[model samples]
Target: MTESRCGYIAIVGRPNVGKSTLLNHILGQKISITSRKPQTTRHRVLGIKTRDQIQAIYVDTPGLHRGQKRAINRYMNRAATTSLRDVDVIAFVIEAGRWTEEDAWVLEQLKNYQCPVLLVINKVDKLEDKAELLPFIAARNSEHNYAQVVPVSALRADNLTALEQTLDAYLPEGPHFFDEEQITDRSMRFLTAEIVREKITRQLGDELPYAMTVEIEQYKLERGVTHISAAIYVERDGQKKILIGKGGSRLKSIGREARLDIEKLIDGKVMLNLWVKIKSGWSDDERALRSLGYDDE
Candidate 1:
């Protein structure tokens, strides 16, 4: 008998539910960039988890949100919803502190799936008393008939081992979707963009997080230095000015911080050039969206 187990699992939830954080924690690497804002992830990212006997082919989908008025925003929402097509299991992440219409809406979105679903109650560390958890757990059980209700805190790494154990029990036996040593499916260019995007989300406040996208236009490996150029796209001229800052100090800081991480990522000194452009509502513009690689209409 073949003893190996592997299957594709989709992570779906509303904004700020810690989906990316959990993926990074499980893989023991930063495959996805995370921040305090919602809608930080603009596309679906694949993170592969392999052990001797089991491998979890995890798909980290974007947080569900109102579809973008433009073509690009449409792609982002589709990236989250489209993963349900051929998955073996679905992991719906939720903040345990409260159950809202949005939570119920996310569960209702899964009514179309025949695959087993796990209700993952994240942010458990925020609760100190066991009694504080009783209602949250019950609320989830009442809202959906989940294959398993696993409580975990992505920030604190709580109950994640139990999650893996439970996932093992329900997954169908199959060959690994990726090779044993594989960890992520994103390219170096995509990762470089993501790294820049993460810093942008942290530095820029408000809707800037959703309005921004990064692209690596050039990456050149030179002697003792990796020369790179990336474009930061925003929707308005005000954003461009804010990002560039007075005397261009703000943009310089973002570049410096992202360059440091890029140096570590490529294991070489980096010479990075950052450019900020206004796309005149790129998130809502289909043509601009397509150019940005989210063009799937």
Candidate 2:
């Protein structure tokens, strides 16, 4: 019998670098919520993929950011940094041909780590000048001696097989930590909440997405259908008004989109209820952050 190999792989990068997209493509499913906006992912999500003799547990963390003025920012930073510990390999994902100060800051955090880091240059599909990629790769490689550098387009699923093969070589040999059938460690309720949050991020304009969060107030299964009631929490009454929109149209649209996705996720009919509430400075309050499920641990 062939011995199995399994280990944890932490996917870290600056916000909007496609860390969530990479994980979703690699696992061939969407376990993490993603949007065009930065900071769409606020928690640590685990996705496990088992192939024959290799099992790679992927840890998708919140994008590491320099902003810590708010309690939510601090919590997100801690969640991203804490995922670095106890991982067998780290995939430091970055965008192709684009680098920022935040990317450099994230690299600085990896300086002290002992694990082998694979510099994953994501979004290669968007690079019109393919010839420029080599020079860009070389420039990044000069910054750090990555264990291996793999360029991939997470959205287009480009060069992912090679990425997987490269990752398989670095994972340590061990038994699988989770069942082969398991795709993610997050609960269905958590996923439901995230789906709702993703809709808000995609549908709403600037500032409203940052000001609000979705909480699953009630989730239950009756007969063959799932019933869910979620609250959209905002810091002020004015924000609540924006979320609800004129005649509650915006909130209804959010619910419609979220409910469709939730049905696909749960693989059943779904009845979703959403309401906007004023949480009054939840993002800046530590206790409020904890109460809204932003605990780092």
Candidate 2 residue 34 Cα shift, in angstroms, is 0.7
lDDT of each: 0.84, 0.92
What's each prediction's TM-score? 0.94, 0.98
Candidate 1, 103-124: lDDT as tens digits: 7777888888899999898998
